[model samples]
Every structure is written in C-alpha cells, then in structure tokens.
Target: MSQLGTLEDLPIGFRQGLTATNLVPLWPNLRGALPHGIPTRRTRPLLWRYSEIRPQLMEAGRLTPIEKAERRVLVLANPGLGLENMQATPSIYIGMQLILPGETAPNHKHSPSAVRFVVEGAGGFTVVEGERCPMEPGDLILTPSGLWHEHGHTGSEPVVWMDALDLPLVFALEASYCTEGEPQNIRNEPDASQTRYRRSGLVPWSGWMRPPTNYPLVRFPWRDVKAALADLASVTPRGEAVRLAYVNPETGRECLPILGFSAVQLRPGESLALPRHSASAVMNIVDGAGVAEIDGVQLQFEQFDTIAVPTHARVRIENSSSTKPAHLFVVDDAPMQRKLGFYEILANEALPPI
Candidate 1:
C-alpha cells in the first residue's frame, strides 16, 4: 500500500481555505478511521475491588440523603475512555448504587436499557411498571428502556446493587433522557419471574396463544441461576466453559436489545481461555476468587469485584480456588454489534457452544 499524505504536508493556504469552508480532506485521515486490522478502542482492562469501593459507597449513603441524591451511585469509569465520559466500555455504563433503609429512589424512566445486579444486603426492592421485584444478592433485575422503575429499602441495613446500562450508546446518539414521575401503584400480583416464567422452557399456557411480550420476565432470581449453572457444570466437559445466557423466556431472545447478559461458572482450578470477540464486555465476579487476563493484563478479582474487557481482546479467566467454583455475571455489547452487522468471534479450534 502507498503511504498516505499527512495533513501537514498539504499547502497551508489550501488547508486554511478548506477549513474556512467547513470541509477537510479524508485521504490523510483514512488510516485512522479504518485501521489495517483491529478497530480503535478506548476501553481498558481494569478491575474495581468491592473491598475498596464498599467503604466509599457507604460513606456516600451517610453524606447524601435519598431526597438530595436520587439514586446515589459511583460510576465505574474507564480511564482510557476518559473519566468524564462515565463509561465502563464504549457502549456500556456501570455504577454501584446504594439505598439506605427507609429510603426510596423516585420513579423515573430513561431511553437507555438498564439492569440491576444485587450486590449486598437484603430487603431491597425495585418496582418496575408496578411489579415490585425483591432484590437479593446475585439477583438480576431488568429496568428496560422507557420502563418506570423505583427502588426502595425495607430492611434494617443498606442495600447496594450494580447498575449496567446502554447509556453511552444512547447518549452518543443524542437520545438519552429520563422523565421523573410519581411513584407507581404496585400491582397486587407477583412479578412475571414468579408467575408467568418460572423456569426454563416453561411459560404460562396463555403465552402459547398470544404474541410474546418484549420483556416477559423482568427479574431473574440468582438462586435459580446458580442452580442452573451448577446443573450445567455437571454435564459440561472439563475443557468447555459453563455459561448460560439470559433471555426473554417467551421469545428466547436476548433480554435487552443493546446489551447481552450471562452467568459463567469456572470449575475448581480451571483456567479457560475465551474466544476473542468484536464486542466489549464487563464481568462482575458473583462468587469465589479468580484472575482474569484481558489482552495480557492480569487482574485479580474476588466476589463483587468488576472487570472490564475491551473489544477484540484476548481473555482468560482462572479459578484461584482448588475446591470451589467461581461464578461471574457478564454484561456485553454483542447484541448491538450483531444488530450493526459486525459481531465476530475468533476461535483457534472447534469448541463447545456457549
């Protein structure tokens, strides 16, 4: 390939004239726009330890009341992407939110889809479109786009949950905004997680006759997911990764449009290398300790610690314990990449489907 001309190589007079007309040449910038191999990425492989964040999060609860700070949170920003951007990856935004006892986060809805993974404490609940879903450690609750959701704590202690959203993507498109409203009048019936979609491959009889709802199940109990992972691990081969994707029970598609979520389990003393993918991802260690090597950067993670992986990066995770399995909750932008027709996975050899 021929070397491209630099912008500075152009005559100053011509460059100034082009700038005055609000136009610039593309020849000098082609390589930067479309790199030879990998696409440019601003995300970095970094881990946030819960041990370090918990104290500051608790201090935030003490310093700010619910009224003053609606949904108090500390964003897990990637320094490579600029801290002011408030992004964990290019398309994903993650934060640790806190709610003290007797406090309530006001009802509001935004354009970006979001999910809450309960981290610590109990008796916390989120009301999504009038269905109150209780929050427990490891539970995954969906607050999809345009859904009115509010959080409250009834327990004696504080509750914290990890908030993952497609805010960066939506905001980049200039379509991100939230509307505050009055508290929802929670319905008397139980959430769909308990009634309509109770188990895998089983839905309400009525669902068979009608069209599938966009989000039939909003809350996935961690207890159920953990059990499912355990059952999957029993049959999974030693070299394969035990993973399960979260999907809409009725349609069996990803639960959200922009982001995808999954639960992964690493067998005791197992070190598994993941296929490199075009999408970026964030993994929150749900249980046990592990070491994750993202594009050659090794990060030590424990329960509740969060790690970020950039696009098209190599990743390997190892269970540090010899007697216990390690579980992780992962959030990724693969769905968005697939929608845009660029999702790809590179594997050296044939492997079991995840």
Candidate 2:
C-alpha cells in the first residue's frame, strides 16, 4: 500500500481555508474508513456470569419497584463498547430483566425488535399483540418492532429473563423510541406456537391460501427445543456441532429482521471450534457448564451465563461435563451483515456457511 497525504502535510493557510469552508480531505483517513482486510470492530470477547449478575439484579429489584422503573433491567454492557451505551455488540443490546410476584411491567412497544429468553422462575408471562405467552424457564418469546407487549408475574418467586434487542442499531439510526399504553386484555385464545405452528413442517390449513405473516409464532418453548436438539444429536456424527436456527415458520427465515437466534447443543466431551465469521455474536448458556475459548481468552461459563464474541474471532466451546450435553442459546448479527452484503466466514478447514 502507498502512503496517503495527511492534513498536516498541507499548508496551514490551505488547511484553515478548508476548515472554514466545512470541507475535509478524505485521503488521510481513507484506510481508517475502508481497512485493508478486516473491518474495525470494537466488540470484545467477554463473559457475564449469572452468579455475579443475579445478586446485583436482585438488589435492583429490592431497590426499585415496577412503578418506579418501567423495565427492571441490568444491561450486560460490553466494556469495549462503553458501558454507558448499553450495547453488547455494535448492533445488539442485551440486558437481564427481572419481574417480581404480583408486578406488571406495563404495556409498551418500541421500534427495535426484542426477544426474551427466560432465565428462571415460572408463572411469568408476556402478552404480545394480544397473544399471551407463558414464561417458563428457557422459553424464548418475541416482542417484535411496532408490536404492543408487556410483562407480568403471577408466581410467588422472582422471575428473570434475558432481553436481547436491536436497540443499538435503531438508536444509532435515530429511530429508537417507545410509547406506553394501557395494559392489554389478552385474547381468549392460544398463542400461535400452541395452535397454529406446532409442528416444524406443517402450518395451519388456512395458511396455504392466506398471506404469510412475518411472525406467525412468537413463543418457542424450551421443552420443544431441547427435545429437537436431542433428536438431532442422536443422528449427528461425533465431532460435529448440532445446532438449529430459530426461524419464521411461514417464511423459513430468521424470525427477526436484524438478529439471528439459534440453539446449539454440544455433546458430552465435545470441543467444537466455530468458524471465524464476520458477524458479532452472544452465547447464553441454557444448560450444563462449558468453557468457551474466544480468540485467546478462555471463559468458564455455567447455566444462565452469557458470552460475547467479536466479529472475525476464532471461538472454541468445550462442554465441561463428560456425562451430560451442554446447551447454548446464540444470538448473532449475521442476518444484518448478510443483508448488508459483507458477511463472510474464514477457516482453515472447510465448514458449512453460517
């Protein structure tokens, strides 16, 4: 590569004239804008242990009530991305939200899409667009953009869930905002997950003639996912990573527009090295314990722990138990990267595309 002329190389008078005219030279910062190979990334590989977060979150619940704090959340901010920004990655925002017994997180909706993965507790539920989805541990519920959603806990214990949203991207675009409204009267009907899209290959009989909806199913039960993973693992050869993508049943695409969600299962005593992809990702441990080696850092994680991986980083995950399989809930910005036409995966071995 050739050296580019810097602003300092220009005469002081010319630099002053350009500054006065509100114009700046591009050559000096061209490489910074378009790097030689990989694009610049600020996301760092980090781990947020549930053991460490739970205490602070519980303290937050004790300190703030539902009326005072609209959504009782403790953001899992990435130090590399600046904690004040409340971002896990450039495009993804993650936080641990809590709801106590007899409390309701009022009705509201926003521009950025969000998903809630239940970490613990039961008898908690989210009503999204009139559909009431029960919150059992490990269930994944969606609160898509422009939809009305709210949370409530009917159980005795404290209910906690991981909230993942595309807030950073929407906020950066200046389109991030929410509107509070009166609580919704949930429809007297079962959610799509229970009634319409129960099976993987089958849809409602009417769906064949009716126009497909973007989100036909918003709730994914962990029981179903775990069973599916078990079935997949039965046939999956050893040394292969068993993973399944969460997609829209009708369109067979990523359920959300920006982030991609998936469930990965690592067999007992398995150490899987994932391909270095151009999308940043976060992995939430759903079951069992494991040690994740990101780039050169090793992070030991247990159930409910979350691990963040930066773009283009080598990641190797090992199941710590020799008798039980480890399950992970993964969130990635691959859909957005692919839409922007820059998603890539690099590895020495031939691996399937993400």
Best by lDDT: 1
Query: What ranges in model 1 sit over 4 Å off?
Result: 348-354
lDDT for each residue of candidate 2 in 215-328, tens digit (9 for 90 to 100): 889999999999999999999988787999999998899999899999999998888888788999999999999889887788988999999999988888999889999999
User: What C-alpha RMSD separates each model from the true structure?
Assistant: 2.3, 2.3
lDDT digits (tens) for residues 1-354 of candidate 1? 899999999999999999999998999999889988899887899999999999999999889988999989999999999999999999999999999999999999999999999999999999999999999999999999999999999999989999999999999999999999999999999888888888778888888789989988899999999999999999999978899999999888999999999999999998888878998999999999988988778898899999999999888899999999999999999999999998999764433221
lDDT (C-alpha) at residue 309 in model 2: 93
lDDT: worst 10-residue window of model 2: 345-354
List ranges where model 2 is wrong by over 4 Å.
348-354
lDDT of 1: 0.93
Q: Report the Cα lDDT for residue 96, model 2.
A: 98
Q: Note the residue pairs that clash in candidate 2.
A: none
Q: Report the C-alpha displacement of residue 161, candidate 2, in angstroms.
A: 0.3
